[model samples]
Structures are given as C-alpha cells and as structure tokens.
Target: MISQHDFRQNVSIFENSLKIEFKVVIKSFVKLNKLFILWLIFVPGLLFSSSKNDSLLQVYNKHHSDTIGLNALHEYARNLQYEDFDSTYKTNVLLSNLCFSNLFEKKNLTARERYINIYFLGNTYNSQSIYFMEKGDYVKSLELLEKSIQWWSLAYKDYLESYKNEIYLGLSSSYSNKGSAEDYLGDFAMAMDSYTKALRLNDFVKRNCDSSLLNFVLNSEAITSFNIAMIFENMGEVNKSQKQYSKALELFTALTKLKDERVVVTGFLGTSNVLTALGKIYFKKEEYSVSIGYYNRALQIINSLNLKYNNRFNTEYADILTQLGIQYKKTQNYNRALELFDKALTIRRELGNKRLISISLNNISSLYYNMGKYKESLLASAESWKLAEEAKVPQQKIKASEGMADSYEKLGNYKEALIWHKVFKEVTDSLTDQESIKNASTIEARYQSEKNENDLKLLNAEKRLAEQKIIQQKADMASFQIKMWSAIILSLMIILSALITIFAIRQRHKRILKEKLLEEEKNRLRTVIDMQEKERTRIARDLHDGIGQLLSAASINFGMLGKTSQIMESESELFSSSMKILNDACTELRSISHEMMPRSLQDAGLSTALNELVVRSFKNTSIEAEFEILGALERLPQLVENGLFRICQELIGNIIKHSGASEVIIQLYKTSNEWILRVEDNGRGIISADTENGIGIKNIKARVSVLNGSLNYENGPEKGLITSVKIPIYGQN
Candidate 1:
C-alpha cells in the first residue's frame, strides 16, 4: 500500500541500516596508538577507556603458559568485550592456543593448576559468547555459551573449594549473557530459565560469601536484576519490571557510594541503565513528570562520564531522550516533547542505527499528531514506516501506520486514511494469528514433554523398586542361612545332652534294684534262721522237763524196792506203777516227735491226717476237736501241704494248751481257685494282746505269707475264737 516514494525510502533505509552496522563493526576494533601511550600513562581513567592495555597484554604474554598468565589474559579479554568484541575474540583465540600448548592435557600439572586452566578455558569461551551476543549473533552466542557451561562444570567439580565462589560468579555471568541473547532471539521461555538459573547461583554465592566476596556478589546480583527486569518488561508486566529495576538501582547506588575505584565504573553504568528502565516504566504508567525526572537523572550520569566515552554513551542517551519525549507528549507539552524527540533523532541518525532511528521518528510523528500538526505528522510517519519495514520491526511499523492513519484522518484525506488504517489492521492481524499458532504449538509440545517425563518417572521408580527387592531378598536369604545353621547346632547340643542324661539315670536305677534284691534275700535267710533256732529251743525244753521227771520217779521206786527186803502186796503194786510210768514216758516222747514232723500228715492228705490228728489229740483230753472237710480232699503241692499242716498243728496245739474251752472245731475247704481252713474253739472269747502276737502266731503268719495266703484270728459270734486261713491254688510254690 506504499507509494513509489515510500518504496524508495524503504530501500534506502535497508541499505543505510546495513552500512551503519558495518560501520559499527568496524569502529569496535580500535587499535592502540603509540602516540597516546604517554598521555594514557598520565590519566589512568583515560587509559581504561582505550580498547587495549599494553601492560595487561605483556602480563598475559609472560604468564600465558601458567595459571597467572591465563587469568591475566582472561581479565584483559573480559574488559575489552563490550568495547571491542573482535579484539576479545582474537585474544581468547590466542589464550586457547596457550592452554593447548601448556597445561590443558599435560599430566605434569597439579590438580589445582589443571583446575585453573579448565576454568580459564571455559572463561575464554564465555568471553567469545559475549562478543557474539554483542555482535547480534544470538544462535552462535547460545552455542558458545553452552560450551562454556560444559567446560566450567568440569572445573567446578575439580576446583579448590575456597575458589568455588569464583567459578560460581563466572557461571552466573555466562547464564545471564545467554539469557540476554535468548531474549533478543524472542525465546522468552528459555530466556527466563537462563535468568532464573543465573539468579539461583547469584543468591547462593551472596548468601554464603564472606565479606571479602560480598561486593562481588552484590555486583552480580545487580546485573542479574537488570537482566530479569527486561524479561518482565517484554512480558508486559511493567510493575514487576519497575520493582526489579528499583532493586537493581538500589544495589548499584550503594556500590557507587562505596567509591571502590576498581568497581565504580560498572556501578555507574548499572545505575544509569536501571534509571532508564524506570523512566520507561513510569512513562508507560502515564507518570510524565516522574518519568522525565528519571530520564534526566540517567542523562546526567551519562554526562558525568569522561567525554572519551561519548560514543559508548550515545545509544543510552538517545533511548532516554526518546522515553522523555513520549512522556512529554502524554502530558500535552508539545513543544518540549518536539524538542526532546529532535534531540533523540539527531543522536540515532549520528549513531546510524536504523531501528533506533525509526523508533525516534515514530515518537515524533505521534507527538506531531497530538499537537495537531497533521502534515508534519504525515511526513514523519511515512518515513518512520519505511524505516521500520527495513528494520523488520513489526511493532514500530504498526505504530507508524496508526500515526499515519490518524494524521490523514485529521487532514480530511479519507482515502489515504482508510488505506493506512487497513495497512495497520492487516499487519496487526497477521501478528495476532502468528502468536496464536505459536501458543498452540507451545501447548502441544509442553503436553508431550510432560507425558514423556511422567512415563520416565514411572519407569525409574519401578527399576528402583525392583533393585530394592533384590537387595532385600539377598539380605533375607543371608539371615535365613544363619538361623538355619544356628538351629542345627542347638539341636545337636540338645540331643547330645539328652543322651548323656538318660545313660546316667539308667545306671543309677539298676544299682538301686540290685541293692534292694540283695537286702530282701538277707532278710529272708535271717528270718528262717531265727525260726529254726526258736523251734530247737522249744524241743529241748520239752524233752528235759517232761522225760526227766518221769524217769526220776521210776528210779526212786526201784531203789525203794531194793531197800525193803521182805515183800508186801503194796510194794508189788509200786513196781507195777513204775513200769506203767515208763510206758507213759515213751508214749509222750512219740507224741512230741509226731507233733514236730507228723507221719500221718506226710502219709495221708491234709483231710485224713487232720481227722487222725483230731482222733488222737482228744482221745484223752477233756477238750474235744472237730475236723470237717468241704469240696475234694485233693493233695496240694509239697510246700503248700507242709506249710498248711504246720499251720494246722500250731493252731491245734494252741487250742489244746491255751484254750479253756470245752470243744474245738476244724474245717478244711477247697474251691476252684483256693483252699481254705477254719478252726474254731469254744474257749475264752478273746486272747490277750501278748498271746496274739506270740512267736507261734508269728510263725503261722510267716508261713501263710510265703504261700501268699491270709490268716485271721477273731472271736466267733457265739463267744469262741475263730482262726481262718485261705490259700490260693495259683502257682502256690
């Protein structure tokens, strides 16, 4: 929609912008003049204003093979990058050659020395990246900066701990410069990330640093604050930008007040840039007076610097003047606004920066329209629109189109006004569509990135869980093996202990049984011996008392007969009596013998023998004995028969001798399982306790016990004594 004149103007602006950039590039490489060396030696400030320092180069050359030389060269390159980027790049290339020659791969270097070389290597790359950023090669700048980060990471890991802060400062500077280039490239997200990382490092150093490093950290923080403010400004968050600028300004002002001559220049430069940003922010907020005041303060700082830096300060001065002009136009001070715009235009023209010049012209056109100078506004806007197109600055172009439309409308040119309005609309719409498409693409990419990240996280977690399970399983297996071994050992101990104990207990029990049996046999033999001795004593007493008395009577009668000489019938009768006494003595001896071992008891069974015994015993006695048998009169075993017969004899003798009863009854009975004997006497109802426990009774009990039979002596119901013995016919021997 531009006329031929506008097209020509556009071509001219493009060519002029190229020429200006070439001129700037050429101007940046200032060579040192030997003639000025004496003058520079007199004024150190002026000495720093030059792009090169011979003394610094000499130190770098001398130490370039060592850490000291590399560090000096790095300082030299850093100082020159802003003023002369080509020199900085060339210097770093030479420094890299030195690193390559001396210590980069040399194993002879100490860890600290190698660490120093690595940091310088990264620093050199950072210097080159800064040079590229300043030269407006953002892609190359980002690439080089990434290399710097990679190399510096190695240095950070191996460097001395006390010097880690230096690496941190260097890294922060690299990231901040990277962010600036990204911001220029219109990569806001990456720029924000870089800025945030830079601030993170800055804050860490600032928080942990001692007083010696505090000023350096403050300087870094101030620079980072200004860089982040630009990001906020671009994002249309002017308030946030204002706050960040204010913070940067505060730090820079404090640094400047310290007047540490070594850092005062950087502090001043930082303060002025912050002030310029604050002025732009206030102008955006329509605070014209405040914006104007901030603009004046920044200009004053630029003016305060040495005149030798006029070229360095030119771009800064023009930017502030343009902001002041915009503010004055907003406040309705058309004349003052025009004056400020003209001043900015002259500076931008002299500087030969077409985009910046276009910005000044756009502002002038706006101011002219505001002042009702329609023709002047139209002319200024048309030129600005052409320059903006050449500069490829779409926002400036759109603004210039708006200014043109307004001027044409005010001048009552409907056709031109309509055309310019359409031009503005088309360009604005195109930008809007492109922004929308970019936002959509960004959203889709972010979603895919998040999904991939989540999937990776899940996979990593599963791998960790599997690894932990394997470790736990191994531990459990080891513990189980230990426990199994312990159990086996304990079981063996327990079994061994049990065997020993059982053997000891069994031996003790066997010994006790043998002693018990030996004791029982001795008691039996002693009992038998005592019974035999008692029986012998009883037989001897019987013989000596009864037979001796009878014989003595007989002997006396014979002696008397011999002494008489003449015989009488009565004396003859005394002889007869002596004979009869001799017969009776013989019979009594037989009875005693029979009682001791009765022939009838051995010859006949207990029934017949017992009957015969009853017949003989009571034949001449006053007390009668009755003997009765029930069941069969079977012969028993010899021991049983002998023991029973002896028991019967003892009972009969006791009855005959001791009982004062008139009669005795004896009964022997046999059953399928046992033999029983009962002897009752109608004598005294009860015996005294002494007679009950007498030797004869004891002997009877002993015999019964040997046959495992029972004997009882109790008073009968009719007032006699009853003796009952029961013998079982079961293996009676």
Candidate 2:
C-alpha cells in the first residue's frame, strides 16, 4: 500500500541518523592515551612492512584468516593510509568486509577491557576514514567518521572511571576530525558544532589529568579555536573571526610556557599557523605595519621548526613568505618584497603544487608592475596564467589576466592592453555565469524532488478513496443480516440476566470479605513499623539525654582533677587513657543511635538525609562516596520515605562490609510521576543466584513491593554492582 517515493522521503530522516559500530575480535592490553595509541598500534604494522616479504602476505601467513586475522587486517589497512592505498586494494576490501560483518561481540570482559575492545573498533573506522579522505572520497570518509564517533561514545561510557578522562580525549579527537569531513561535504554549521564539542571536552580533561598532558591539551584547544576562526572568516564575520584567533593565540602562548619537548613541537606548529592567520586579518583591515610584524613573527617560528624538524613545516614556511611579501609590497618596499616573493616561488616549485606556483607567480607579476618593470611583469603574468589554467581555478585565472592587462598598459602597448582587458572582462563574466548556473541547478533539483513527493501523496490518497467505496458497499449488504439477529439476541439476553445477577450477588459478598481481611493485614504491618520507630526514638532520646550527659560530666571532672592536682607523669598518662576509653564509648553510643534513626531523615527529607548518610559513613573509611539528587523534592508519604531511607542504609552497609569497592554513589531523584533510588558500587557484585536470596536483598525487595515499586540489579564479575528501585508517586496512595 505504500508508494516508493513517499516511503523513501519519509525514511530518509531516520536513515541519515543511523549509527554503525563494531567490536574488535582480538584483545590487547595496550594503554589508550590519546593519539599516542596510534604509535602503539601502527608500530607493529610498520615492522611487518619492512620484513623480507610483502606486509599483507606476512599478516595472512601469521594469522591464517582466523579471528586474530581480522585484527591483523585492520592494522595492515591502517598502515596503508600513510602509503599508496591502491597498492593493497584487496586488503582494504577484506578489512571493510570484516568490520561490517559485526560477527564479534563484547563479552566476558572487564569494564576496562571492554572499553579497550570498543576503542580498537573505533580506530579501525578512523583508519578507513583517513584513507578515504586522502583519496578525496569524502562521503565514505564521513560515514566511517560518524561510525567511529558511535563506537568511541560507547567506549567513553563503559571505560573504567579512573581512565574515563583518557577515553574522553580520544573521543574528542574523533569529533575534531569529524568536523573536517563535514567541512568537505559543505556543511559548515555541523562542523562548527563539532569543533566546539572538542574544545569543551579538552577543558574537562585539563583540570583532572596530569600536568604533563597540559601541552597536548593546550595544543588541541588552540587548533580547534583556529578552525572555528577560519569558518567565521569564510562567513565574512571579521570581528568574530578575530576574537577566535585571539583566543587561539592565547592558548598557544600558554603552551609555549610548558616544558614538554615532544608536544612542544606540535605547539610550535599550531602557534605559527595562528600567527599567519592574524597577519592576514590585519592585512585585510589595511594595518600594514601590524600585519608585517605578525607575518614576520610567524615566519620566524616556521623557519626554526623546519630547520629543527627536517622540513616538517616546509609548506607552512612557503605560505608565510608569500604573505609577508604581499605586506612588504603594500609598503612599497620593492627590493625586500621581491626577495621574499622569489624565496616563496622557489619553495612552491619544489612542492609541485600548480595552484601554489600560480599564486606565487601572480604575486611577483603584480610586484613587477608596481616597480615599473613592464616586460618582467608581463612574462611572469603569462607563466602564471598557464599554471592557473592547468590548476582549473577560475579565481587564479582572473588575477593572472588582470595582471597581464596592467603590465601591457604600463608598457605603452595600447592595442595589446585593450585586448587583454577585454579578455579579463569576458572571463570574469563567465565565472559569474557559472555560479548562476550552479545555483539554478540546485533550485531545479529541489523542485523536482518536492514534485515527486507530492505526486506520491496524491496516489496514496486516491487508493484510500477506492478502498472506502468498497467498504461502503459491503456495509449495505450486511444490513439485513443484522436486522434478523437483533430479536434473537434480545431473547437470549433476557434469559441470561437472572443467572448473571445471582452470580454477582455471591461474588460481591466474597469480595467485600476479602477487602476487609486485606485491610487488617495492612494495619498490622503499619502497626509493627510504627512500634519499631517509636522504640528506636525512645532509646535514642534516653541515650542522648541520660548517658551522654553523664559521660560528658565525668570527662570534665577528670580533666579538672588532672589540672588541679600535680599527679605524677605516669599516673597522669594512665588517667588520660582511662578518660579516652570513656569518651570513645560515649561517641560510639551516640553514633549507634543516629545510625538506627537519622534525625535528618525526619527533619529535612531524602536529599539532605542521603547527603548526611554519605558524610557519616565515609568520614573515616577508605572508600570514596558521592550522593546526588535530581528534580525538585517535596516530602513524600512517611512510609515511602522511611522505606527508601532504610533500603539505602542496608545497601550501603552491605557495600562497606562485603563489597571491597573503593567507590560508591547514591542517587535519589524524582521523575514526573515516580521517585527513583539508585545505589551503585565498583565492587564484586552478586557471586551466585543464592546471593539474591540473602536477608538484606530480600528486605530491599520487600520494601519496594510494599510501595508498589520495582527493583532491578546489574551484577558484574570484573567490577560494579547497581541497585535501582523505582516507585510510582501517583498510585501509591
């Protein structure tokens, strides 16, 4: 009944939001510490690559296409991204097939191990994404990057809490790189959101991680800021762009103060790029002196890094020189500008990029015209034009043609200048025409798509109308049958009424008796609990009022005796130890009474009571604890509050005595229609089914059942146990 066009249009929203992830087949204990993980993973592949045989063959021979063979294939394919990916086409296809097969599952693993397993899977997709990006296939790259984000999110959530920050750093890197893929697909808005997320994650990691990671975090922060600034500049928001650039520079300035040499190399690279960007911004604003200063600063850093790191920033160095030369030319410093331009041209030639070479040549040609060297300017313009054409960049062609016309005019060649000017005007017009055509095509495509969707809707409407007509004819045919049965049904109903009334009378009496018995049981339970609370309160009051005061008075008298009399030193020490014993007994007794019934539970409510419990329980224990509440809190029915509080008290007692967990968290939160109490510990969970039948667990379940609530348990062998109890607020009464 569904039309094809309608189905596709309706499903695209869901289709585009789907996430694809996989688990790794092999296990490894390698630490996941940022992108440094790449070194650990790829170093093995690098060694295999240099072996006496081909690397892919070596991988196959080593694993023989078993489970581990999948891991080998993944690493092998990852290494290929840094080389010629086409050289091992079969390996790429096999790895992709294995990852998409989803045959492996995460099981029988610790939280940390499971985190590692999913992280490896994420990196597998990241490797493929990098390879496709290098090959200029952004659609496939975007798909894999999105998949990697999915797997990494799982890893981030499942990782050992102690190492969660490390896992988050890896996820942040994926987001930042994913933004690049989005940028290539012409989706700048999504890209901006992605970069913002990356910076925010780094802000979290910076506070909690080691100071050694400061350099790495700062560098990433600066890079994301620089990327955001570039997007702003592209959208023609100059003030906003300058603000982001300034933020990036400030981060870079801090990074330079760090002492980590390995990451400082990265800091230098990012810092130089920021400087170059600032120089360009100033140049646009016609601040020549300021622009020249910034460009030279960037040039110095790029030049030093290149010298020390084996030309690692050779491309950056060339770009800086070209920009600096343009600034110098603006100031009419012809000789110095020419020198810088020549240096840039030489470097671009070595790089063998047609576009960069054309850009350099055009800069020199314009400078020559400025210097009144018409013949030299014309020659450079002609060469630049040829390269621009080869590069297929229309903007470059426009600059080259305009430069040629200016050179010819300066030479007094009137006819040649006129012809070149006409060519420049025609090329500019053609560029505008091309943009108009592209826009028209986009509009036409949207119109066609909408028309197809509307046509499908019309067809579905017509089909519904035809089905309705058939239903109407069938109803008319059934009218005579209904009339015949009406009298027979009425007679049968009269006969049944007498028997039905007799049955109802008997059942109603039984139901009333049952209700009376149930109410008696409910009253008994309420009476017992109330008696227990009254008993506890009476004992606490007596202990605090009677014994506690007596002990305090005795301690004061003992202290006064020691101060008033000059007792011998050893005698004084013995008396002091006796006093300490009495004092500890007083403290212990008071604590027992508070534990039996916390004053806060009755005085303030669950949120304050839970916080007080955590403070009292962990004040001297080795275990760490946390308590949180969500949503607004109001006093609940007294029985509900008491039951939840007692249940938490028992849960925490069990954890402290038997769980061996170093960490625990208690949460009491309210939903719109329900209240939830959750207690979790990173400890040995239930060891066997019998553990659930223990007295403490049964007591918790009993309390939940009384409140018309449900309880669920998550037990982990390697780590963690969580107890979740949900009670409906509406139906309890």
Candidate 3:
C-alpha cells in the first residue's frame, strides 16, 4: 500500500500528466485543423483575469472586509476571465452578472441601469482599448486606459476617493507605462516626468506597507525606475543613472521580501540583476577590480540559487566577460584576452543573443587592431558587422557600422569609412523618426478612439433605455386592456343573466293570467251551453206531450168534416185531401221539434243520430250525398254532437239553396284524440271571395278556433266549394 502522502502525490502527478497529455492532444488536433488553430490562438487569456483561487480571494478579502459582498462579486468577476467562452455560453452569462453586480449597486443603480440598456457599449470601448494595446498600439492603449480611468473616476468618484492611495498607485502605473511608451517614441523628457511621478507614488505607498497594494505600487516603481535609469544612461547622465538603478534595486528588494517563498529566490536573483547593472556602471568608470567583483557576485548568487539565467542575465554576463577580455588585451595578455572573448562568444551563441555576439566580435576585432594584425582585425570586424546587421537592433546596427568604418579607416579606405559612417547616421535617424511616429500616433489615436467609443456607447444606451420603456408601456397597456375586457364581459354576463331571469318571470306571470282568463271564459261558455241544453230539453218535452195531442184532435175533426161533406164526389175528395194535409202537418211539426232538441244524440250516441239525419236529409233533398264513417265514435258528448249536427244541417241547406248542381260527399272519422269531419259538394262552384265574405265561413272559423282545431274553405278541384273542419277531442278540457 502507498503511504498517504505518496498516494496524494501520485494522484497530483497523474492529474498533471493527464492535463499535459490532454493539452498536447488538443494542440496536435489544432495544428491539423485551421479553424481549431484560430480558436486556440485567440481564445485563451481573453478576459484578462484568472480563477479566484484561495490566494487571490485571500488577497481580495483581506483588503476588502468592509464590503465582503463586493469582494465576492469582485472574485466572481476575476474568475469569469478564465472561463472557456469558445465552447461555453456560461462565460457570457457570468460576465453579464459580474458587470451588473459591479456596476448596478444601489448607489449607482440609476446610472448603471442606463448603462446596461445598450449592454455592450461601455464594455466594447474597454475591450477595444485592450485589443489595440495587445496589437502594439501603445498610444491607443494609453488613450483607452486614460479614458477608462476617467470613466471609473466619474462612475466611482466616491470609491476612488475612499481608496485614494490605491487609486493614486494605479494612476501612477498608467502614467509610468504611458511614459515608457513615450520614451520608446524618443520623448525622453515626458518619460522622465512620468517615471518621477511613479516613483513618488511608490515611495508614499511603501511607507504604508499594505502588502497587497504595495505589490502593484512597488512593481510599477521598479519598472519605472529601470526605465528612467536606461533613459539617463542613454543621455550620458551616469550619476543620475546610478542613483535610479540603486532606487530600483531597493524597491525590488522590498517587494521580494513581501512576496511568497516560492518567489523569494527569484527576488534574490533580481538583486543579482542589480549587481550586474552595477558592474556595467563600474566598467564605464574604468574600475576594473570593482566591476569584476560585482560581476562575480552576480554569477555566484545565480549559481547558488540554481536559477536558470534568462536572456537579461546571460547578456549581462557576456558583456562582463567581454569587458574582462578587453582589459586583458590592454594589459598585453593577448592569449588570455582572446580566451575570455571566446568564452563570452560561447555564452552569446548559447543564448542565441546576436547583439551580444556582435559586441564580443567588436571587442576581439579591436584587440587584433591593437596588435598590428591588420588582416585578422579586418576579418573580425567584418564578422561583427555581419552579426550586427543580422541582429537588427538599432544600437547593434550603429556599433557594426562604426566597427566597419574603423576597419576601413585602418585599411586606409577613406571613401569606404565615410560611406559606412553616413549609412550609420541615416539608419539611426530614420529609426528615431519611425519610433517617434509609432509612439505618438498610438497614444493620440488610443485617447480619441476611447472618447468616441464612450460617447457612442452612451448614446446607444440611452436609445435602448427609451426602447425598453416603450415596450414596458405597451405591455402595461395591454395588461390594462385585458383586465378591462374581462371586467366588461363579466359585468355584461351578470346583466344578461339578470335580464333573462326578469323576462322569464314576467312571461310566467303572463301565462298564468292567460290561463286564468281562459278558465273564466270557459266557465261562462259552459254555463251558457248548459242553460241552452236545458231550454232545448224543455221544448222537446213540450212538443212531444201538448203539440202531439193538439195535432191528433185536429186530425179527428177534419175526418168528421169530411164524412158530412160526402154528398158530391168532388167534395168527398176535398174532405179526404184536407184530412191528409192535417196528418202531414202534424208529422212535420213533430219532426221539427225532434230536430231542435236532438234527444237521440243525448240518450243513445252522436253516431246513431248522425246516421239517422243523413238518411232523412238524403231522402228529402234532390242531391245524393255519400258519407263514410270510420272508428268507434263513442266519446262524443251531448253538447258537442248537437253543435256538429246543427252545423252540418245548416251547411247542407245553404249548399242546396245556392248550388244548382247536386252531388255531395261527407266523411267522418275518429282518430287518436281527435274527430275529423269533411264535407265536399258537386254543385255550381261558389266563388272563394264570396264564401270568405259569408257569415258561414266566419261561424266555421269561430267554432274551429273554440275547439283548438282548423277550418279551410276553398274551391274544390272539380266545380264546387269544399269545406273541411277538424275538431280535437276533449279540446275544452
């Protein structure tokens, strides 16, 4: 079994190996795929921050305890930088959240809300600025940084004021970098002032040793001091230059002390770098022993720390070796000097440091020139010139041209030396002009672009904000309309429901009233019908008793009169006719009394009475009528049968009186819940208009309506009018 620590170590090693292998695989794939290669090239280091490891958060949290939430937000902001946005949308989401959290504090809510409406405006300006800076547009970078600083100033005036020292340190770094860019552009005076300002901030922040803040401050100061020292050295201000170098060393030392142990050895190595610079200075003053001591001290420290010497140290080491070589050559130790020069060249070549190689070559060539080995000196000088030209550094080019000029001059080639010197001057002057243009243009364009982008962003933000407001208003209006419509529909539904209830109730009351009126009318009609039936019964009874007795007495008297007048034959015939007339008159009177009351309909049934009437009417009339009967007509009441029989008699009488033709047909049938009666005649056709105007049609309509049935009178198909009526059974009920 592995020990716990060893197991952990193994796991870590495995993880690291996996990471390396994965990266290698990805890189290989990317090399094969152009699209992947493009993505890999531009994808990493995009947001310019790293993950918030414990160390970084600790740094942030220790400094910003007063605003832990803000510190958390800041950590989140920083962490968003490393998110692989190429394949993931999470980064954009996190970035947006970070932006909102940072900008939209309650303090800046109003302004931030306006700012976020355009979303990308302010962010785009900042992004473009950083983009230009990376593209070597130092001037543009500086301008954008300054604009960003101004934006932070306006946007976080209170925050900056509260964090005055930190703000000043940041401003100093910006100015210092701007100055360095200016220095590269050959604006040495501006560079000097900027470096001075940076040093001032560095000094102030150093006294207040807040390590986290001091890190940036001291780092900026060290860079600025180094730059200032270089400028002084260039201008031949050796004393000022040494002072600046010493200041840079002090600041770097102070920073290293505060750094982590991992970087502590590197800090000592930084001190070694200062020793090398000191060596160069001493060499410039012709203090050979002191210069050697500084150089040896630097080399000893580098070896002790086991540090891999970078180009800076390697170049410095080579210079010192060349210097030693030159000093030996002056002491007439030509072989020892040549050996030193060879050692220096080896280091230069190992470094692939062409500029140092040229310098080494120049030293060797000078040493040869001093020994009167003219041909050997020219060869060395030509090699140095070639190396210088290949190096392409401005200083290297000048040194190479000078070396060639010297070589030519020594060879007595005056024209060649003049041409090399002129070429040297021309190259240096053009380099200086081009460098100036690049630096100034970078600064100016950066500043203007930042300002223009900021303005455009502000405008876009305002427009977007206005659009959002309009959309919100429309949404609010729509919501209001929806509510209004719902309320209106609800109210109308309630009103309609109430109206239907009221209408139904009123109709129910009206129906009840109609039923009450019909009941009263039916009762009155029933009473009249009962009284008329009673009167008819009384008349029929009177006719059967008294009128029959009177007619019998009259007939007997007429017979006696006829016996007395029997002398002449004509007289006897008269008496016989009179007696016969008396008998016929009595019989007709009895029939009239029976027809008026219709006792048979009351005692027996309507069907028997109707059959007897039909037989008698046909025998009395010239017209022959055929009647067909169907169904059991057992349900007929006395009043209904009498009314129907009277109606039929009146219709036949009218038809016989008016019609010249003679055939009639009557049909009676009893169906479910109804009795149907139809009368059809064949006679001279009656005009429809005349029939409608007659009282008979009106009577038939009234009777049919009383029974809740229907009556129709029209010209029959052949020649006469047809009248039909259907009365519902038990309609009165």
> Where does model 1 exceed 4 Å of error?
1-52, 78-114, 129-140, 154-163, 259-262, 306-311, 332-335, 349-355, 365-733
**Per-residue CA lDDT of candidate 2, range 1-733, in tens?**
1122321342334323433322232233123442354344444445435442255546655663345656666556644432334433335444444443332433454554444445555666666675565444566778887767666665554453766566667656776777766765546899888887787778788878887666667777777888888888867899999999999888777777777654566577778888898999999999878887888888889888867655646668988989888888988999999999999899878767666788899999999988888899999999988987765545567788878877866676645665666667676675445443343333333444556867646655775697688778778768766876887798789779978998899899999999888667656655666687788888887887888889888888987987898999878779889889988988987887787777888898777877888899888899999998877789988888888888898888888888899999888888988899988899887635666678887777767766768898887546789889998998666
Q: List ranges where model 3 is wrong by over 4 Å.
A: 1-187, 204-209, 261-266, 305-316, 319-368, 371-394, 425-733
Residue 42 accuracy (lDDT) in model 2: 45
User: Could you tell me how far off, in angstroms, the CA of residue 475 lies in candidate 3 after the best superposition?
Assistant: 87
* Candidate 1 vs candidate 2, TM-score winner: 1
Question: Ranking under TM-score, best-scoring first?
Answer: 1, 2, 3
- Residue-by-residue lDDT tens digits, candidate 1, 23-49: 543343224442243233323333343
Measured on C-alpha atoms, candidate 3 has an lDDT of 0.62
Residue 682 error for model 3, in Å?
99
Q: Clash totals for all models, in order? A: 1, 0, 5
The candidate maximizing TM-score is 1
> Candidate 2 vs. truth: CA RMSD?
26.9
Candidate 1 pairs with clashing backbones: 63-69
Q: Candidate 2, 672: how far from true, in Å?
A: 54
Give the TM-scores of the predictions, in the order they appear. 0.46, 0.40, 0.37
lDDT of 3 by residue, 1-733 (tens): 1122411333444334534544544454434653343234334433333443434444534543123433453344334332322212222322333343344333545543433321322233344343343233446655654543343333224343355565455555555665755664456897787677667766766776576675666566677787788789778899998998898788667767875542454356567777777777887788879988988887776565544322324545565577667667867899899999998989877756555677787787777777777667777777877766654445656656666666666676656666675666676776445443343333333444546867655655785698699889999999999999999999999999999999999999999999989877656655665676688778877887788779989898877766665558767667678788889988887887777776677777777777767777778778888877875667576556765766677677667777765888887787777777878887776545776678765555545555567776677897887877777786555
